[model samples]
Target: MHFAIVGAGFTGAVLANELAKAGHNVTVYEIRPHVAGNCYSERDEKTGILLHKYGPHIFHTDNEEVWNYVNQFTDFMPYVNRVKTTSQGNVYSLPINLLTINQYFGKTLSPKEANDFIKSLADGEIDEPQTFEEQAMKFVGKDLYEAFFKGYTLKQWGRSPKELPASILKRLPVRFNYDDNYFNHKYQGMPKNGYTPIVERLLDHANITLHLNTPFSSENKVSVDHVFYTGPIDAWFNYNAGRLGYRTLDFVREDHEGDYQGCAVMNYADEKVPYTRISEHKHFSPWEEQERTVIFKEYSRKCEEGDIPYYPIRLVNEKTMLNAYIGKAKKEKNVSFMGRLGTYRYLDMDVTIAEALDASRKTLDCVNKNKPIPVFFVNPL
Candidate 1:
């Protein structure tokens, strides 16, 4: 069977590779000139540092299957994302560890003592936290919330914490121990060469044909047995239902000698600060040495037409529109919507790859059984 996969990101690339391996003709269309989408990385001309063109993407996951899958393509270097944040004119470890708590409060407390202290600071009145602010206040208390989360959340989402859902804050951890590793995943590392090579290898199959700088719109008719779309769901229908809200990012690149922030990622948790985080690209690839460094000061804002959407602002209004698009997507024949943009959710790299793998398996099963292909392998809603 002939299959069409949209966007040459991990989603499309994985699907194309799987289908091609099954002896099916697979054609991938990537609007961008690059293959890895947001995960695209290249060496800087001057600094010779591998720059994450979109932003720093640290691959961390507890999924052993995903770890083994990615390993087949490129060698991964031993790298743990130890993030730092600058808040209230001070540098502190991220995930609100014991060191951060002690430093912020000017007290050297034990793990048990710190846990009790934080609990005391938490607002007991709020029985069930609904909003992001309430969740933070209930978990880490008002002081830490204001100092660490409030300003950064506002800058990242361009909205007050009160307006956002509590689920957003649920992802953030507040630890009593001094473990500052950003993720609790078993496997955490960056590709030795960069993500682009992994994707290139994924697409390098006999039956797979990759088309760069080719945009696939719903209007464009293709002669394929099935279509796997990884683009925005609303875009597939030309925003007939309404455009789903999204937050886009703008990176301001700067070159410097030696280390810039002395860290891979240094987030600014002050509202006064314009950019949310400054990522030193050279630090991302620590296996290689470089005298010069390149940094990107990332700015977040409302996504507009032609802007590369990063985070899906899945507020109440956007959810309604998303459901409308999902309904329309289900009604279409011979098309499957997958990936972060198609599903309209903020997904981690591991989750995206896992989902793509699952989708490919399901697609093959449906074909072998002579069953109709599903509009969605994973429920978007």
Candidate 2:
């Protein structure tokens, strides 16, 4: 079977690799000069630091299958994302742990004392949270919410917390203990050689052909057994409905003589700070040592026509548009939409890989049964 995959990112690359291994001819078209999509990482020629081209992507997931699968392509270095934040002229650890609670209040409270204190601060009136503001207030109360979340949320999403969904803040933890680890995952690490090499290795096969800096469209559609599209779902149909809302990021790069922030990520809780956080690239790979350091101050805004979409803003309007696109996609022939962009969701690397593997297995099953390939292996909505 012959397959044409659009966008040589994790989804496309994984699918291409899986299908190629099963004796299928795969052709990958990537508009960008490089692969790996938002997970793209490369070394800076001047500083000699391996910079995460987009931003810091800490590979953390409890899924054992994804953990083992990724290990096959590249060796992952042990890395844990410990984030720091600045609020009201004070530096604090993130996730609002015991240490942060103590530092913020200037009191040495035990875990039980801290928990009870937070409960006292919490808005006992509100039984259920309907918005991000309500959720935060109920969880950690006004002072902590305003200090840490309010300004940052406004800057990151370009919207008020009251207007956003409660689910956004639900993922954030308010720890009683002194654990500052950002994620609670069984497997957490970064690819030693970087993510680009992983995708390159995936596409590096006898049955797979790579096309760099190529824009794939309906015109580029060829006589193939199936098409696996990892590009924007709206763009695939030429935005017949409307563009889905997404937040794009602009990175301000800086080079310093020595250690900059002394951490991988530092979130600015104040709205006065233009950028959300300043990430020191060298700190991401603590195993490697370098004299100079590189950092990127990340600024978030509504995704423009040509800007690379970083995070999907799944607001009501965006979801409506997405559903329309999904409806159109379901009726399409010999095509399978997979990945974050295609599904119109913000997916971690592990979830993306797991879905791609599932899609590939399903595709092979369909071929064996002489059935038409599905429009989506997993529901987009």
Give the residue spans of candidate 1 off by over 4 A.
Answer: 217-220
* 191-252: candidate 2 lDDT, tens digit per residue: 99789899989999999999999998676675676788998999988898989999999999
What's model 2's lDDT at 62? 98
> Candidates' TM-scores?
0.98, 0.98
* Model 1 lDDT per residue over 41-150, tens place: 98777777888999989999999999999999999999999999999899999989999999999999999999999999999998889999999998888899999999
lDDT of each: 0.92, 0.92
Model 1 TM-score on a 0 to 1 scale = 0.98
TM-score of 2: 0.98
Residue 361, model 1: lDDT of 95
**What's the CA error at residue 376 for candidate 2, in Å?**
1.4
Error of 2 at 169 (Å): 1.7
